[model samples]
Target: MDTARENRTWGALSDLPGHPMMWVLILTETVTFGLLFAIFAITGVVHSDVFSAGRAQLDPVLGGVNTLVLITSGWLAALAVEARVIGRRTIARLLLAGAAALGCVFTAIKVVEYATKVSVGIGLETDTFFTLYFLATGFHLLHVILGVIIIAAVAMYDSLDNLKTGTAFWHMVDLVWVVMYPLIYLVG
Candidate 1:
């Protein structure tokens, strides 16, 4: 590849945070979720009553707690990246572990919330609101699970770039939840 042409083609990657290739994954996932969010907003507007009733069924307080958990986790992940960059490998690993633990906590809370909904006979088939509610949240929950795994793996592997990449994914998970929580649980 010609050097200048190659730089022209791949130059934007140089400015992205974490491993350059990881940004590709990030962009793809973000666009996917963005579409889901758009669809959700449009559908909610179309069926305002259904969405409103579904929102009433949710516990905003619990969603708030999960928001706090993920935010804290993302903070720890950022700290871990900084630590790794500074050659504090042990501290970095510990911070990554902590971040992953918070991710697990988020997962547990979400599972409990789902269980509560199920026990009350609320589920995917209940209505349009419940259906989108389950699908969107469920998909995001799966990403959270994967993020926890990635964070844990990066902690074990112990490389600065790997840590950055893993935590970048975790942060995306956090951002998605930050957006999704209000839209699904509190918004009209």
Candidate 2:
């Protein structure tokens, strides 16, 4: 109600672990990815055969490896938050670096996968399945790139708030893949 109360109320939001802005962004990203997943599911249901063949063309082993890598990156990002909290700025920076490196590795693998698709003459208009695959994963890949940039900034700036915000973004990226791996690669 009063000014102090309002400030306190806003500050209370900060006490919930990460920055509130980061949480808001995470919610936005989640909704966007959720809609994409829904679209994928509906499209797959309509063209079941094409979707099945598309999933088969994808290498589940590579998807699994990337899943492992991203999860580890998310863990490292969490550690970065802990390290920053305890005044271990250097360690936090190093951990952020590790996380960003893992994200880049994931991106590289995606690039290779895209190349494989290209070589096989699979373009955006190749079919409904390929179109959805590229749209979903390619959008996710952009998020990965943005997450890496956030990691770099947090590592250099080195604050509890920065670490929390950056890692929040990184974790969202990882979460998207967790759904995407099964939805686009393993399932029909």
Candidate 3:
């Protein structure tokens, strides 16, 4: 309790959704991804032709579909948090489980995209664009996988702090993808 109170000196971050520690993780990760994203954008501007050529090989429609999937999952996660707040354990659990299921769906689609890339001889080593594509998306995918585990653990545990923290992390995952889709797919 004292530690949590001490953390509150930082202001909104201490009071933000989820555990204080979770907020710290979220902030750290946000900065990390922000830097990576900026680098990607800068690289694109420097090597416009290569970036455009790489973007041309990607399927924007698939990225769009994944965006929708992630948004829906984030919504479900929000609902889970709401339900937990209202003393509806069963509903919260169901919603968290559903959110995790949607994460799985996102992973499945990514796997298919990767397999397609492999079949077409496109890989991280293929080109600069492909390398950046794999690095950014692959890193995000790791977060999605971690979020699933966190969500599932929170569901079974049914602790308010854990629920809030886990769902917040999941939302972060969703957010990164939302930004990534436009950069890696739509921007060209």
Candidate 4:
């Protein structure tokens, strides 16, 4: 009876899951990003002049557009997860594709922005502010790239169950951008 009960419990836990591993992964990622943000905050406070000057060089309009793109992608991803939960596999795939495409758009824009900055002689070596700006944004861009990959993986999966795991990771990526957008674009 005890063996049967144990088997039942294991089955219930594993079978009733939607990306059980994603929560732990997301938690670790959040802590890493949180530390990066804290470092930036401390540096900004202590070196306001450098940060302010570096920020002045940034094109707020471009940043604003990127922010919009990320937010929209996040919305789409959330919808995709909902669709999956409801067993609408086609809609979920479409939404996941849309989210992935938006991520590509974001990366393209960032490339252009970075090229423009480099052409104008503004780079990581320019100043303390530029250094921090590039480091933070570059790290975030890496996350975006990873998100694109994950979303693409979800798009390729034939089963909703498989796609659900990728969606969870994508959601965490979206959450990070929501925090980053306001912090990097508006507050400075």
The collision pairs in model 2 are: none
Off by over 4 Å in 1: 1-9
TM-score of each: 0.94, 0.93, 0.94, 0.85
Query: What's the lDDT for residue 181 in model 1?
Result: 93
lDDT score for residue 152 of model 2: 97
Which is better, 1 or 2, measured by TM-score? 1
Q: Report model 3's TM-score to 2 decimal places.
A: 0.94
Residue 50 local lDDT, model 2: 89
Q: Write the per-residue lDDT of candidate 4 for residues 96-153, one digit (tens) a residue.
A: 8999999999999999999999999998899877787788789889989998998888
Residue-wise lDDT of candidate 3 within 49-158, one digit each (tens)? 99999899999999999999999999999999999898999999999999999999999999999999989999999988899999999999999999999999999999
> Comparing candidate 1 with candidate 3, which one achieves the higher lDDT?
3
lDDT of 1 by residue, 61-153 (tens): 999999999999999999999998889999998898899999999999999999999999998999999999999999999999999999989
TM-score of 2: 0.93
Instruction: Kindly indicate the candidate among 2 and 4 with the higher TM-score.
Output: 2
What local lDDT does model 3 show for residue 150? 92
Ten-residue segment with the worst summed lDDT in candidate 2?
A: 7-16
Error of 3 at 91 (Å): 0.5
Clashes of 4: 0
Clashes of each: 0, 0, 0, 0
